[model samples]
Target: TKQLNFLLPDSDATVAFGKRLAPALKQGAVIYLYGDLGAGKTTFSRGVVQGLGHNGNVKSPTYTLVESYQFSEQSVFHFDLYRLADPEELEFMGVRDYFADNNVSLIEWPQRGEGFLPEADLTVSLAYEGEARQLTMTAKNVRGIAILAALKS
Candidate 1:
């Protein structure tokens, strides 16, 4: 797997990076976001949603489990599974439908989804580094390798 590391000095920098990452996404891209509470996962996701042309707020789906945003070209699904009690609940919610070819899935607390979720093309992990944040992105497949390459370039 190919990996990239970034030092985000603040929330703005994290969002900026997410914006930069957005254009590299191919249709049906699945990205897993791994981070602790207050690690800026939602802020980064907001950047991705905005980068994909969503004009409104990109709030976390912590309670809702998933929020869908539609664009002319594709649909983006932002999923926060932090509050989920069982992974099987995803099946009941028609989670597989969210991974359709025309959609991009951004999942937080992906581990909670476990067997219910498809393999992520890319995984992004965020951690605290003093008052700043450190982000590590790993490519898990061909598509992820391409996206990471674009980000590097």
Candidate 2:
């Protein structure tokens, strides 16, 4: 998969990108988010959830690990593996259940859960560059490619 580079001038731009990305999401899609703490992962997720018609407070699953949302049209599971002690804990927590039919999974710190987590359709890496942020999005599969295409148009 090739990487698509995007420049986010500020936190608002990152959030806007997520909002635009939400409508392109499909069932069974997995999105892996890579970034450092305070890099706006939660902010982006909030926009995505809002774009998906979820009008509530969106918080990081730092303690809970995963937050599952059941909407009228789709189900979304947001996972934050920052607090994970081991990838094996995922199985014990029944992480597979979240990947069931018609669900879209958004994962943060996926590297911590490497072997336990499923392959991501899309992988977005965010990094701070000066006063701006750099977002590199890569599509690992056809579904993700379609999402990139949609985002472009």
Candidate 3:
């Protein structure tokens, strides 16, 4: 596993980090976002989606569960499982199908869908640090390692 840690001074810094992160990812990348409410997980994801070529609005799918953006080469799926009462709820939603090739899944509250969700390529944990935010990213597979290494360079 590979890990990278950084401090984001503000929302803009987090967005910048996410924009920089977008290039290192590709299709089938599953990124689990862990953070408390208002910790900027959605803000980071918005940056990633916009950086990946989505021109429309990017908002937390808190009530919708998932929101998808279609791109020429890749599709980005944002999921918020905070409202989920059971992991099995994902199975009924055909969660597996959403992770198909050419798809990038950014899952928030991933713990809520543990058993149904596939292993994440990367895990991003955010914490409040003063008025800023701290990001701790873990690469779980070869693909994730490449991403972290690329970001390092």
Candidate 4:
């Protein structure tokens, strides 16, 4: 497994880090985002969607559950499962369809969807650190390892 850490001094820094990870996702990936409320998960996701060619605003799918952005080569699905009442709800909503091999899926509050979601290729955790945030990325498979490797360079 590969692991990378970053100290983000602010929201912009977190978003910048997301942008750095964007290029490595051209082949698509499943990224699980772990963090408490206000930890910048949505902000980071916004950066990724934008980096992939989204020109409009990227809002959290807290109430809607998921939002999708389309680029020329790939699609990005941003999911916020904080409001999920049961994992089965994911199945009811056809959530599995969102994680296509050719698209990127960024899931926030993934623990809420537990068994219903696919295995993540990468996992990202963010935590509050003084006036900043600490971000950690862990590679769960070969695809993730390649992403981290790309970021290292």
Top-lDDT candidate index: 4
* Poorly placed runs, candidate 2 (over 4 Å): none
Candidate 2 worst ten-residue window by lDDT: 20-29
Prediction 1 global C-alpha lDDT: 0.91
The true-versus-predicted C-alpha distance at residue 12 of model 3, in Å, is 0.8
Pairs in steric clash, model 3: none
Q: Is candidate 1 or candidate 2 better by lDDT?
A: 1
lDDT of 4 by residue, 1-153 (tens): 399889999999888888888998999999999998999999999889988878899988999999998888888999999999998999999878888887999999999999999999999999999879999999999999988898888
Q: Model 2 scores what on Cα lDDT? A: 0.86
Best by TM-score: 4
Q: List the candidates' TM-scores in order.
A: 0.96, 0.94, 0.95, 0.97
- Model 1 is weakest, by summed lDDT over 10 consecutive residues, at 20-29
- The candidate with the higher TM-score, 2 or 3, is 3
lDDT of each: 0.91, 0.86, 0.90, 0.91
User: Residue 60 of candidate 1: its Cα lDDT?
Assistant: 86
Weakest ten-residue segment in model 4 by summed lDDT: 93-102
The order by descending TM-score is 4, 1, 3, 2
Candidate 3 per-residue C-alpha lDDT over 1-153 given as tens digits, one digit per residue, 9 for 90 to 100: 399899999999998898888888764589999999999999999999988878788988999999999888888889999999999999998878888876899999999998899899999999999889999999999888988987888
- Cα deviation at 81, candidate 4, in Å, is 0.2
- Residue 144 in candidate 3, Cα distance off native in Å: 0.8
